[model samples]
Target: MDVKRISGLGRNAAGDLAKGVRQVGPGGQVIVVRPANSNFTLQEYQNFVNNFKPQQPGVTFRVVDEAALPK
Candidate 1:
């Protein structure tokens, strides 16, 4: 499985992400890593999930907190 690291999320980015996910087919995994202090709001997060969910119903999505990562 090829891993892709995206800097952040936006309309175009999300679209591209969805497209990539579709290309990967089902069982694909998408791990989103947030910054140490992220400014993304709850609604935005929900929207992000909503956007990708329909595109790839079988894909797995995970959010990783950067601060929680071992330095």
Candidate 2:
């Protein structure tokens, strides 16, 4: 599976970016970087994940704090 990292983007923008990536038809994980000032809400994130579930069963998307990423 492919792994993608998306940072510095709001909810809508991040969703757009993820959708673009999904067009490639690769099932993978999308890691959204959640900063202190991020406007990405938990509900929005869940909706984003759920929205793609029906279309692409292999795709998995989630949000995480920037610090949680491995060096």
Candidate 3:
């Protein structure tokens, strides 16, 4: 499976999400990497989903905490 990895979503989370959707298209997986104490919030994450759902249906989106990942 192809994964579209996005790291460090500071102020441009939405834009990055759009890019990911475009890159992966439909039926693709998106892995978002953010810090445990990141500025990104769940509301924003949901907004990304709500905005892109119509354009890219059946896309899987997952957010991963960089600080929690095992090395």
Candidate 4:
């Protein structure tokens, strides 16, 4: 699977998300890996995904907590 990884989410996250979506192209996945100490909340991440869904169809946007990743 084609994946675009992004570290943390901030005020300028949308731009990065857009770039990631474009980089991965259609049907690709953009994974935003949030750091443990990130100031952004899960709700914010979800909001970003929700907002982008309509704008970019076929592109998968996901936010994963860094702590949840397998070591």
**Greater-lDDT candidate between 2 and 3:** 3
What is the lDDT of every predicted structure here? 0.61, 0.55, 0.61, 0.69
Query: Tens-digit lDDT track for model 4 on 15-67?
Result: 77778777787787888776778677777777766676424568887777878
Candidate 3 TM-score, true structure as reference:
0.60
Candidate 3, residue 31: the lDDT equals 70
RMSD of each: 3.2, 4.0, 3.5, 2.6
lDDT of 3: 0.61
Ten residues in sequence with the least summed lDDT for candidate 3: 1-10
Output the TM-score of candidate 2: 0.45
Model 3 Cα lDDT, one tens digit per residue, 16-48: 776777788898777766555656665565455
- TM-score, candidate number 4: 0.73
The superposed Cα distance between candidate 3 and the true structure at residue 55, in angstroms, equals 1.8
TM-score of each: 0.58, 0.45, 0.60, 0.73
In model 2, which range of ten residues has the least summed lDDT? 1-10
Best by lDDT: 4
Regions of candidate 4 where Cα sits further than 4 Å from its true position? 1-11, 53-56
lDDT of 1 by residue, 1-71 (tens): 32344445787657656766776778777665556555774345546755665365678766566666679
